[model samples]
Each structure stands twice: as structure tokens, then as C-alpha cells.
Target chain A: MGEKIKVDRVTKTFVVRDSDQKGARKEFTAISNMEFSVKEGEFLTIVGPSGCGKSTLLDLLGGLSTPTKGRILLDGQEIKGPGLDRGTVFQQYALFPWKTARGNIEFGLEAKGIPKREWRAQSDHYLELVGLKSFADRYPHELSGGMKQRVAIARSLAFNPDVLLMDEPFAALDAQTRETLQSELLRIWEKTKKTIIFITHGIDEAVYLGQRVVILSANPGRIKKIVEIPLKHRLADADIRSNPEFVKARHQVWSLLHEDEYAGLYI
Target chain B: MVAISKQVKSAKRLHKLTINPLLALQKLVKQSIVLLLFFVVWEIAPRIGLVDPAFFPAFSEVASAWWNMLLSNELFSHFSASITRSIAGFGLAIAIAIPLGLVIGWYPIARDLLNPILELFRNTAALALLPVFILLLGIGETSKIAIVFFACTWPILLNTIAAVRNVDPLLIKSARSMNISSFSLFYKVILPASIPTMFTGIRMAGTGAILVLIAAEMVGAKEGLGYFITYSQYNFMIPEMYAGILTISILGLIINYGLLALEKRLSRWKQDPTV
Candidate 1:
């Protein structure tokens, strides 16, 4: 499978107040000349520093916001605002607090106008996929942070969208939980074979999960380099940590980030 | 350290046994004490001549008047009349406010055109329109009920508009991405989320309906608690007037509790987790 979604020369800028001038607004660029494409059923992660506008790029692809310039195409069609083909999972769980886990997962299918009987089976299937079958009847507040994030992923995937866009879904969890959820997410990705574009601030997460890691620079975020992962199958977590080549890639990415950070301060 | 640990364990057991029962009794005993204090003051005020017995009837006199009203079955008739009017008027308001609010809230042009007019009318006292309603509808049940409807509608309409307008943007975006579009969006996404807030408005409208009913009855109606109070005052039946006031208070309490119970049942999802 090759390239289900393509972004071309996407640029997004918001108006900001000029620091030196009183009451004067200036154009502040968030993302400039950003270009990428997700191969059909490929899992990719974009990793960068805090203000690199990784989220801005995700929103553009997810169709929550329109790019100021250029275009995004899915299956050779120009992308418009949010469509059913692309599903997004936010950093916060964003599940409806009023709905139980089952209710929330079924929301997408409900909107699709599926019959009520079908919703029960479909929703329960996805609930079990995320290992929340036991807690299906429970509300969002009933779950811990990791469980809530799992529910969010289940909700996005329940509708069987063509592309999944996730914006740092597990960043809020503790270190141990984050690692666990990362592996769970990889497992889900492998089983489902859905095209995924994940945004993150963590280097380890990007290297661990991505077929191709797109490193972005801060201040008018642009792609600095694309690092391809050669390891094809699941490697032991300890083995990946101990590999000499993995250490080299980590250090190389760290230095690139350092350069971007220093350059950003002067700007 | 061993002795200290044993003492802490015993204290924990003691706490488990006594705390729950003590909390329940504390709540009940506190309320009972307040009521007892009120009755004590009421009984003493007339006997001590703090207030003259002629104008301010004794507690026993008011109690006897209450018993007489109940025995005559007149109190029940007045209570029923007031309740029917308030409920009918409030029901009418709900029928009108919901669709109008949705239209106005969803469309910016409609909201800009209509909102100022709504704000103007809401601030205008509903009782001030009583004479106008009487002039138009001829001082009968229609005029009185119209007044109650006018008073009750504003809160419901305003709250509907607010709840619709203030739905979280993130939720809407999330819904749209999931392919939830215009019509289903309102019913599934907007309406369910807005319900808790909308129920707040409904509760307010319930109170407003009862309040306006009382005032409306004072004008020309023959069969409500407000009319009974006015009639008693006219005939110099001071104790009976107090009895009517007491009946209205209990009626208000019942209506409030009824709406609250319904709200709780409908909004189980919003139940506070801490409790």
C-alpha cells in the first residue's frame, strides 16, 4: 500500500501582537512549507520540540483547520473540512463525559445512521479491542488516564476510518503507563493496519513506533529530516534500548533538536 | 511503636462504627432543633405580649384556621386550581421556547436580529402586561394564564439559547470529524450536552410560573390560593389569610422538590462523583 494522504506546501499563520510595538499585531507563522504523505496503512510519527507546530500540522491534515496556502489530498481528492474518512484522537481524551465508554465508542457509528442493534455489537467489539470491555458501562471519569486514552483510540478506530490522526494521545500519562500504552498502541496499529499520522514531543516514542520519523524544527515548523526505521518486526523493548545503532540515531536526533532550540531563542 | 499501632487500629474500628451513624443523626437533629426553636418563639411571642394577640393571631388560632380550611376542602380546591394554571402555562412556554431558541442560537443573523428584542421583553416585568392581557383576553382564565406564560417563557428561552450557543467547540469538531452532520448533530451532539443546563432553565421557569400564577390570581381569578388570601384579607379573616399563606409556601416547596427530583433522574450522568 502506498500514500493514502498527501500534504503539499501547507502553511499556517496566526496574527500575534508585536513585542516591541504597542497594540500592533504582526503575522506569526506556525508552519511553513510543510510537506508529507502517509502511505496507505503506514504508521508515522512527527517528533519535534515544544513549539514546533506539530499540532498545527496535525489539525491541517485532520481538517479541523484550513491551511493558509497549499493543499492536502486523500485518495487523489482535495481535502475539505473534517470528513468521516479521517479520524482524530486529541491529546486530552475528549470523550463525552455524559456518555459511558460504550456510548462514546458508538457515537461515530450512531452519527453514521447505523441501526441500533448493530451499534451494540460494533461498540462492544471496539471496547474489547482496547481492553475496556469490562468497563464498557463506565463513564469517562470512572477510568484512569491510560484507560481514558484507550477509550479515545477505540472511539476513533470504531468507525474504521481510512486515516487516523493522533495528537500526543499518551503524553499526559505517567512514564510507566506511557510506555505500556505506547506498546498497546503499536499492537493495535499492527492488527488494524490503519494509516496513522501521530504527533509527539518525545524522541523515544517517535523512534519506537514510526516506520519513518519526521523531525521538525521550531518557529515556523518545517521538516528537517526524515529517518526511516529498518527494523521490520517487534523487537524486545530492552533490545531496542541496548542497540548501538538506536543510540546513534537518538544522539543524532538530540543534537538536531539542540540546534533548533538555540536557533529558536534568537528568533 | 507496637502499642501505638494497636491504639491506631482500635481507633480506626471505632471511627468505622460511629462516624456514619453520627453523621446521619447530626443532620436530622440539626433540622429538628431549628423547627423546635421556631415553634418555641412563636408560642412565647403572643403570651409575652411581644405582639398584640388581636392583630397577630396566636399559633393555635392559625392552626385551627388551617384545620377548618382542610375540613371544608376549600384549600385543596384552591391549591389544585393554582397548580393546574402554572403547569399549563409552563407547558405552553416549553412548546414555544425550544424551537425558537434553537433557530436563533444556530443562526447568527437570526440571533442578531431577535436577541435584542428578546432581552428587552425579558427585562420588562410580566405583571406589567397583566392589564394588557386583560384588555385583550377579557379578564378571564385566558388573561391570567397568559400572564403566567409570559413570566415563565423568558428564562426557558434564554437558557436554551445560552446552552445551545455555549456547547464546547471541541465536541462539535470531534463530532464533525466522525461524520456527524447538521440534523443529527443537533439532536445527538447538541441537545444531550445542553440538557443539564436546559433543565436549570426549566426549573427556573417552574418557579416563575407559580409566582406569576399567585399574582395573576390576585387580580380577577376566583379559584386559586392567591384569590383565597385576598378574599380572607377583605373579610378581616386574619387567621385564614395566614393559613392561605402557609398553604402557598407548602405548595411552592412541593413544586420545587418535584422539579428537582425529575432533574436528578434525567441527569444521572452529571451526578457529582465526590458524593
Candidate 2:
């Protein structure tokens, strides 16, 4: 498979005013010399400790912010700014409070100038895909945390983007709801075959969903290691977590992440 | 099966009790009783000579004066005149303030340039400028309308600026990641998100408009409810004066309710019916 997204020696630095010392500026390196690539149609999960700049890296990939050095390429083209080719799902479930579930999903479609007649069908398809067909009319406030996240996922998917950048999308959900949504996500991924770059701090989640898990360390976050999961069957199948192979793969990711001094701070 | 059937039946009964029409009627009747008692005391106190009749006219006396003015259509003309001036001034304020607020809020440079001037004018009560407005615009409708406009503009303008500036950063980040155009990002995300705050300013401005307009009318005009009250007072027409004062209070109430209804209709999403 061809490389769909490539980060080549990217570095990001932020200049913040020192609150304690007046007129003094401090430079903080969020990430330094980060390099990775996602092949077409690959599910890549990035795991790291808190303050690791995992989110900053995702921001770079999503084209929400530019790197201080190096460049990110999509299909060999340098990414300059945010574009509709990549859709993002936030952990906060940033669905517009003013919009109903279907209206939120149709936001991108409306931005693309899709014919008004086609909006309902396109939104309905993704709502059903996320198992929220009955909740199309509900506002975000009316929906539960899990349901809101599902609507957010469906919203990003409905826009028919080539890449999905999900930032801890299910981290706020309850354990059972998180597991159910993880399987649903895998189902959606299989059906759409869209390349997904998922960010999380959960080792088991990183292993369960990713074909390749990119582990990042804190303190000017850089890739610590990249572990490849060698599951022989679909991850969404029940009892896969009980399989010896799944347990072993999960342990490999956990050990790599735990070796870092900052690992205990997050998980 | 029997337990499941019993649970469903109980749920239906609970829903019925919560939404019962009779319960709603009872609440309304309970509210009206207090108002009726207030009117009863007001009518009896003056009749029984508990207070001087000239100063504390009977409720029936005010009612008959109101009815007489209504029959003569004198009340209608005064009412419509006040309504027209207030509406014109308030509507103009909305048109000017909302756009200015949105622009100033969105652009830091604009905010920096305008904020001091806004603060200065907002702090200076609009009523205090009555003489100056009359001097510049003359004691005509223009001066009255201008003062009302001045009073109504600040709340809306300032609130709009605050609302636009305070939108959640996460919402903006999510919208940006979609690669939506700048215009779409603003109208779709920023505008709707800022609406609740914007409405807050508008409601305040609505009240301000009525208050300022009535005060301005009392000072200069010969038509509005404010003028009617002063005219009746000088003539010692106590009942007519009270009628005019009552009209102002009623007008204020109606304006507040109307704005509230509009706010409620537009912000249906903010309401949590579950609570």
C-alpha cells in the first residue's frame, strides 16, 4: 500500500509568556523530530503518556496547526492547512449544541454545497451506520455521552472524507459503552475502508483497534516504538480479548509504554 | 408477564399525572388568586377612607377612567405613538449594535480601538444626555428616538462582543478540522454558539428602550404615555394620571414577555425538558 500520510522530521515549538516573570517569554517544545507514516487504508492508533504532545501531533496531521520544522505530506503533497479531505472526531463530542443529530451530521455536507435534497439521505445513512437512526431528531444535550460521541463519529464519516482523525473519541464513555463503540468503529472501518488515525492513552484499545500502534513518550514527545499487532482474525469478534494472542500483543504494547519514566503518570 | 404488565401500567399513570390538564389549570388559578386579592385591597382601602381618595383613588375609579379614555380613543393614539417611537429606536439599535458587536468581538484590533469609547458611553447614563440631545437634535421626535437608541444600543453591543469572543475553542477547532470555509465556520459555528449570549443583551436592551423612551417623553413630548401622565398630573386628573402610569407598566410587561417568547423559541435546544 502507498503511504497516505507521512510526517518527516516534524518539530513543533510554542512560545508562551512567563506568567510569573513579566514580559519574559518561554519556548516549550511540544514535539521534536517526530516521524511516522500511515499506509492507505491502515488503522493507526497513537498511544502516549499525558503531556506527550500526542494531541499536538494529531493537530499537525489534521492540518489545524503547522509544524515549526519539517513537513507533513498527504499523497506526497505538503499539507498547508485544514481541508475537507480529512475529518476529525474530538473527545469532547463537539457536536453543535444548536443542531439536532442529523443537522450536525449534515454540517459538512452543507459546507460542501451538496444539494439540499440529498442531505437527508446522506445523513440518515451515516446515522444508521452508527446505530443512531432513532435519534436523528435529538439535540446533543438530549443525548447521553456515548450517544453524543456516536453522533460525532457519524458526523465526521458522513462527509465522505479520505482520512478520519479521531482524538480519544471514546475516552469519556463508560466501560461497556466504550467496548461496544470500539466494535462498532471496527465494523464501520471495515465497511468504509477509510484510513483512520486514532489517538488514545489506553494500551488495550490501541492494541485492539490498530494494525500498527505508534507509542510516543512525554517530555518533547517522540516515537518510542511502533508495535505491529498480528491478529489472525477480525478484532470485533467476541472472545478475541480472551485469546492468548490478544493478551500477548496487549502486554507487548504495555511493556514498551511502561519502560518510559513518565508512563505511570497517565495509565 | 404480570409484573411487566403492571410496570407498564404504572408508567402510563405516572405520565398522565405529570401532564394532566387539571394540574396546569390549578397552578394558573393559584397565581390569579394573589393578583385578585391585591386588587380587592386597593379598591377597599380608598372606599373605606383608609387613605385620601385624591391620592389613592379606588381601583374602580382608575378602571372607569381607563375605560372612558379607551372609548374616546385618546388612549389608543397615545399608546400607538409610544409604541412607534420605542419600536423605531429599539429596532435601529439592534441593527447597529449586533453587526458592530459581531465585528468588534471577532477582531481584536477593532475591539481594542472601540472598547474604551464603548465603556465611556455605556457608563454615562443615557438619561443624563437628555438636555444635550435636545440641544443638538431639538425637542422633536429625533431627540426622543435618539435617546432611546442610545439607551438600547450598549447592552446588546457589549453582550454580542462578549458572546462572540467567548465561544468554546474546542468548537472552533472541530469546525476548522472539517476544512469548512471561513464564512461557513463563522455563520454555522460561531454565530449559533454566540446566540444565547446575544439574546441576553437584546432582552436588557428591550427593557432599557421602554424606560428611556418613557422618561424622555415625560421631559419633552406631548403624546406618549409619559406625557399623558404628566399632563393629567398638572390638571389634577388623578384617575387619568394613574391610568397613564398603569399603561406604562403594562407596556413594559408586554415588551419583556414578547422578547422572552422570541428567546425561548430560538433557543429550544438549550432547554432540557427532562429537568
Candidate 3:
């Protein structure tokens, strides 16, 4: 596969004002020197502790925010702003509370400027893909955490973007649901063949999900290391967490993350 | 999507209302006990001379006075007059404040520019400005409606601003990532999300609409419930005044619950209907 996305020395900085300090300006760097590219149809997982600018990186890739330093290129075109070419699954689900499961999926299709008459069919197809066909009419408030995340995934995929950027999408789910969703995500990714960049703080999640695990460090976040994982675990035919190769890979990610005390993996 | 939701709606309706009618009615009566008790006390207290009937009439006396006005059709004119003014002022305020609030809430520059003026006007009570409105617009229907409009604006405006501001940032971020157009974002995400909170402001403004209009009418008005009450009071028709007060109370209750039902309908997704 050819390069699908290129983050060429991307850096994000936010200007924040202190409430107590009148007219005082301060600069906070969320992420810096994020130089990486994703190949087409690659399942890349990024692992880092909280506040490591993983979310910032995802925001930049999604075109919700622009990089302070360098530009991001998608299929060799500069990404100036948000576009329908990229779909994102936020950590918070971010499903509109007012919309039903089907309505939420239609949000993407509508943004993509797809015909109104086809929204229902496309939305239902994605809902079934995430195995929530029966809950099509249900709202986010009525859904469980895992169910809501599934709907979020369906929402992003329904838009049919070139790449899907996820920011700790399953971090809030319980152990069993998280594992089940990981397997399901792999299956869906295989079927769709969409390039995915999944961000997480879990060692096992990174090892199990990604073709390559990109480790990041906090406090002026920068790429720490990128570890290539075993192929079988990445393909995920079945529960592979107990596999020796998976454990070894997980340990390597764990050790790499813990080298810096502040960047220790919480999971 | 529409068909699926409709099916769910019917299924839910069927699953609900399984409660026996008798039990539901019994529960309703149980909840009404305190209100019934208060009315009972008012009736007995005046009749027993706990409070002199000359000053505070008995409930039966008030009821008879109310019935007399109802039969003579005197109450209908006043009720209609008061309602028309309240609705006009309230509707105008909603039509203006909601759009203005949405704009100010969403845009930082707009919010900053208008905030000082809003605070200044907000603290100046609507009733306190009645003299100014009368002086400027005169003591006619225009002034009365204007006062209600002024009184109602703050609650609806402030609440709407807060509602727009308090919309979950995550929702907007996600929507923006999908390249949702600015116009679509307003109605699709911001407007619906703001409904529940905005309704709170609107309900408060509903109460303000009545209270402010009545006070304005009492100042100088010919045909309204407020004028009726003050007229009856001046003539020492205590029972008639009480009747007018009762009618106002009922009107307020109806307005409140009506808005509440409308709010519940628009924001149906907010509630867990199954529960």
C-alpha cells in the first residue's frame, strides 16, 4: 500500500489566558515534531499516557485543528481544514444526544453531501455493520458505553472516508466489552479495508490492534518509538491476548512507555 | 430511520400504560392531597371567622362571585384581553431573543460586545421601567405588551446564551470534523442540544410574561384580569377580587404546564421513556 497520510513535522500550540493574571499571554505546546505517515489500508495504533498530545495529533489529522509548525498531507494534498475525506471517532463518543443511532450515522452522510433519500439505507447498513441494527431508533442517552462507542464507529465509517482517526475510542469500555469491540473493529477493518489510526493508552490494545504501535511521550509530546507487531495478532482471527507473541509485544510496549515516569501507562 | 423510530414509539406506548387506571388515578389523588388541603383550609378559615369574611371572603363566596362573572360573560373579555397582551409580548420576545442569544452565545466577539449592555438592562427591573415605557409609548396595550416583552427578555435571552455556551464541546468538535457546514451545525447540533436548557429560560419568561403584564395593566388598563382585580378591590368587592386572583393563578398554571409539555415533546431524546 502507498502512503495515505503524511504528518510532516507537525506541531500544535494553544494560546491560553490565565484568569488571575490580567492580559497575560502564555503558550502551551500540545504536540511537537510529530513526523509520521500512514500507509493506505494500515491499522496503526498510537500509545501514550494521558496529555501526551495523542488527541492533539488526532485533531490535526482530522483537520479540526491546524498544526502550528508543519502541514499534514492526505493522499499528497495539504489538509487546510476539516473535510469529509477523513472521519473521526472521538474518545467521548461525541454522538449528538438528540439524534438516534441511525440519525447519528446519517450526520456523516449528510455532511458528505450524500443524497437525502439514500441516508436511511446507508445508515442502516453501517448500523448492522456494528451489530446495532435493532437499536437503530435508540438515542445515545439510551445506549450503554460500549454500545455508544459502536454507534460512534458506525457513524464515522458510514461517511466512507479515506482514513479513520480514533482517539482512545474504547478507553471508557469495560474489560469484556473492550476486548469484544477490539475483535469486532478488526473484523470491520478487514472487511472495509479503510486505513485506521487508533490511539490508546493500553499496551495490550496497541499490540493487539496495530500493524505498528507508535509510542509517544508527554510534556512537549514527541514520537518516542514505533514498534512493529506480530502479523497474526494484528489480523485478530480470534482472542490473541494470551498468545506468547502478543504478551511479548505487550511487555515491550509497557517497558517503552514506563521508561519515563510521567508517561507510565495507567492501564 | 423515521419508520424505525415510529415503530419504537408505538412499541414503547404499548409497553407503557400497562398500569391499571384505578392505580394511576389513586396516585394522582395522593399527589394532590396537599393542594386540596390548602384549599380546604382557605374555605374553613374564612367561614369560621379565623379571618374576617369582610376582608378575606370564604372560598364558596369567591366561587359564587366567579360563577356570576362567568354567567354574565364579564370574565371572558378580561381573560381574553390579558391573554392577548401576554401572548403578543411573550411571542415577540421569543422571536427576537432566541436568535440573538444563539448568535451571541456562539460567537465570542458578539458575546463580548453585548454582555455589558445585557447586564445593565438585566439588573434594571421590568416593573421599575414601567413609568419609562408609559412615558415613551403611553399607557395603552402597546406599553403593557412592551413591559411584558422587556420583563420576559432577560430569562429567555440569558438562558439561551447559557444553553448555547453549555452545549457539550465534544459534540461541536465531532461535527466540525465531519465538515458539517456552519448552518447545518446550528440546527442539527447546537439548536437541538440547547432546547432543554433554553426551555427552562422560556418557562421562567412565561411566568414573567403574566406577572409583568398584570402589574402593567394594573397601572393603567381598561379590559384585563389585572384591571378587573384592582377595580373590584377599590369597590370593596373582596370576593370578586379573589375570583380574579384565582383566574390568574389558573392561567399561570396552564401556561407553565403547556410549555413543559412542549419542551418534553421537542426534547424527547433527553428522557428515558421506558422509565
Candidate 4:
């Protein structure tokens, strides 16, 4: 596998005015000296506690925000700003409320200057891939949470970006829907072979979905450890959760994240 | 169980046939009865000497006066003149306010420079500036149109600014991540997102245009609904004045409904019945 993304010594600082104290300002370090690398076509998941800067790191990778210290690279080119090379799926399911599911899916394609004649067929394909063919005409407000997320995924995939940056895309969903989407996402990743950087706060999800799970420590967010799951094969069935290797991998990530200071905080 | 199920099915069919139509018919009847009662009282009160006939005319007398004005073409000319002036002023306000609002809302520097001035002018009543407008533009169509423009501009401008600024940040972030060009971003995301709020401002400005125009006419115009009503009052033509007032009310209603229909068409996505 080739190196797809390289995050080298990235640090993000936010300067906030102290509203309670007159003329006082403070600097906050969200992530400090964070470094990681992802291989091409790999499903890499980063799991962390709240405020661990998982989303911030993903933002940097997607070129939505600039790092205060180091830099990120894609295919040996330093990331400067948002581009079509990296497609991001936000936790809020950021489909334009004014557009229907099909329109939302076609948004990035349209931005890429694709011919108008191809937009419908391209959008229809993605909609079908996400199992939302019947709901192509529905607006975001008319869709359920799971359905909205599916549309969001379809939209990002239709753009055919080099990498998919998902920041807790399934966090808002219920348990059953989340599981169903998790399987669907795996199936998509296998078929498309697109590099995915998935960020989540769920330990079970990180182990279940990622080829390598990177556990992040809070308080100036930094990577604590990276664990590689030794599954015999890629998840081909929903019953993988019952396999010994899966449970063991989940427990290993849990203990690492559940250490003294962060104990009792549910992942 | 079978008998109970059969009875329930029959009851459902009965409800669909009778209750639904009965409810709709009842609503129509209720509304008509209220309007009819109002007209009946209006017709009877003045004729029975419940009020002074010089000041208060019966419904029939007002209707006949309205017909007379229509035949003479006096009401039509005044009505058309008022409509044309108001529409011109309202259109000018929309053309200016929307672009200004979009620029100010999008750029912090522009907002900072203009906010104080906007607040100052918005708070000052447009009617209070009629004398100044007349002095500047002279007591002609220009001055009347200017006053209407001033009255309508503030609401549309302020609402548009608020709308553009308050668009969900996540939507913009998502759009930007797709590498959308700035022009496409504004056209596809920002403008559409801000439309509902912008429409609110437009509707307010529409109402404001008519109001300010009528007030300006009342103060110093020779032709308009306001002038027609005031002239009739001065000459003690009570029924003619009532007719003018009714005409103005109907005009306001028509403007409001037209704007409402436009808003509905533009924002059909908002009406999610399933939600």
C-alpha cells in the first residue's frame, strides 16, 4: 500500500477572548504535535474522548482549517485549502435543505463542472448504491436520520474524492441504524477502494470498522497508541462482533482509552 | 372479531364520505355568515338613524357611490396612479436593499462601517422625514416615491442582512469542502439559504411601500387613494370617502396575497407535511 496522507507534527491553537474578564484573552491548544499516516485504500479510524481534537485533526486533513505548527500532505503535495481531492462527511448531515436527495448528491459533481446531461445518471447511481433510490425526490426535512446520513454518504462518494474524511458520521443515529450504516459503509469501502479517515468516540465502532485504530488522549490531544486488528478476513458478515478476535481488539482499545484520568467516561 | 372489524370499516367509510365534507362546508358557511352579518349591520345602522347619515352611509349608498366613481373613471385613475408609484418605489428598494444586505452580511468590514448608520435610519420613522423629502425632491411624484422608498428599504435590508449572516455555518463549511467556487457558493448555498428571510423583508417592504405612499399622498398629493379619500371628506361626500377607504383595503389585501403566493412558490421545500 502507498502512503495516501501524512500528518506531520500538526498543532492547532485557538485564541479566545475572555468575555467574563475585561481585556483578557487566552490561547487554547486543541491538538499538539499530532502525527499519523494512512495508506491508500485503508479504513483508518481515530477514536478519542470528547474534546480530544479528533474532529479538528480531520478538519486539517480535509484542508478546512490550517494547522498552527506543522502541515499535512496528500500524494506528496502539502494540503493548503479545501479541494475536491478530499471529500468530508460532517456529523450534522450537511445536505442543503433546499435541495432534494438527488440534488444534494449532485452538488459536488456539479461543482466539478460535469456536463448537465450526466448529473442525473451519476446521482441516481449513488442514490442506488446507498439504497435510497425511492427517496431521490425527497427533501432533507422529509428524511429520517439514517436516511439523511445515507444521502450524505452518497453525496461524498459521488464526488469520487481521493479520500473520505468522516467525522462521527453515524454518531447521531440510533444503535440499530448505526450498525446497519456501519455495514453499508464497509461494503462501499470495499467496492470503491477509497481511502477513508473515520473519526469516532465509539470503541466498538473503531475496532469493527478500522484496519488500524488510533486511540487519542485528551488534554492537548495526542495519539496514545495505534492498534492493528488481527481479523482473519475483512468483515463479510454482521456476526463478526461475536468473533474472539473482534472482542479482544475492542477490549484492547477500551483499556488504552479508559486509563486513569479518562476512566468512567463512556466511549 | 370479524363483526367488529366489519363495523369499523363501515364507520371509516362513513367518516370519509360525510364528516370530511361536513367539516369543510361548515367552515365555508361560518365565514360567509360572519361577512354577511357585518354587511347587514352596516346597511341597517345608518338607514335606521342609529348613527348620523352625514358621516355614516348605508352599505347600499357606499356601493352606489363606488359604482359612480368607477363609471366616472376617477377611482380607476387614482388607483392606477397609486399602484404605479408604490410598485416603482418598492421595486427600487428591493433592487438596492438585497445587494447591499448581501454585501454587508458577508463582509464584516462592510457590516462594521454601515451598522450604525443603518440602525439610525431604520429607527427614524419614514413619515417623520416626509417634510425633509419634500424639501429635497420637491412636492412632486419624486418626493412621494422617495418617501415610499425610504419606508420600504430598511425592513428589506435589515432582514436580508440577518438572513445571510444567520445561515447555518455547517452548510457553508460543507459546500466549501467540495471546492465550490465562490460564485457558485454564493448562488447555490448562500442566496438560497437566505431567501426565506429575505422574503420576509420583501413582504414587509411591500406593506411599507403602500403605507408610506398613502401617508405621503394624504400630506401633499393631488391624485391617489389617499388624496381621493381626503378630498371627498373635505367636501362632505361621505359615501365616496368610504368607497375610497374600501378600495385601499382591497389593494392592501391583494398586495399581501400576491407576495404570499410568491413566497410559497419559492419555498416549497419548507412545507414538509410528513415532518
User: How would you encode candidate 2's per-residue C-alpha lDDT over B166-226 as one tens digit per residue?
Assistant: 9999999988988887888888898999989999999999999999998999999979898
- Segments in model 3 whose C-alpha atoms lie over 4 Å from true places: A16-26, A233-237, A261-267, B1-23, B272-275
TM-score of each: 0.89, 0.94, 0.93, 0.92
- For TM-score, candidate 1 versus 2, the one ahead is 2
For candidate 1, the TM-score of chain A alone versus the native chain A is: 0.94
Relative to the real complex, the DockQ score for model 3 comes to 0.48
| CA lDDT, candidate 4, residue B172 | 97
Report the C-alpha lDDT of model 3 over A128-243, residue by residue, as the tens digit. Answer: 99888988998887777788898999999998998989989988888877887888899899999999999998888888889999998887888999999975745434657777
**Model 4 agreement with the true structure over B117-191: per-residue lDDT tens digits:** 999999999999999999999988999889888999999999999999999999999999998888988989999
Q: Chain A vs. true chain A, TM-score per candidate?
A: 0.94, 0.96, 0.93, 0.96
Clashing pairs in 4: none
DockQ of 4: 0.39
- The runs of at least 3 residues in candidate 1 whose Cα sits more than 4 Å from the true structure, single-residue gaps closed, are A13-28, A230-235, A238-246, A261-267, B1-23, B58-60
lDDT, candidate 2, A1-267, per-residue tens: 889999999999999898889999999899999999999999999998887898899899899999999999999999999988898999999989999999999987886678999999999999989877877898887677778898999988888889999999989988877887888889899999999999998988998999999999888888989989998666545878988888999999889888856556765
- After TM-score superposition, the amount by which residue B124's alpha carbon in candidate 1 deviates from its true location, in angstroms, is 1.4
Give native contacts recovered, as a fraction, per prediction. Answer: 0.56, 0.71, 0.76, 0.71
DockQ score for model 2: 0.46
Clashing pairs in 3: none
lDDT (10s digit) by residue, model 1, range B77-130: 998998888888888998998778877888889999998899999999998888
Candidate 3 lDDT, B1-275, residue by residue in tens: 33335444654664465778999999899999999999899999988889998999888899999999999999999999999999999999999999999999999999999999999999999999999999999988999999999999999999999999999999999999988789998988999999998999999999999999898888899989999999999999999999999999999999999998998899888865557
**Cα lDDT for residue A180, candidate 1:** 71
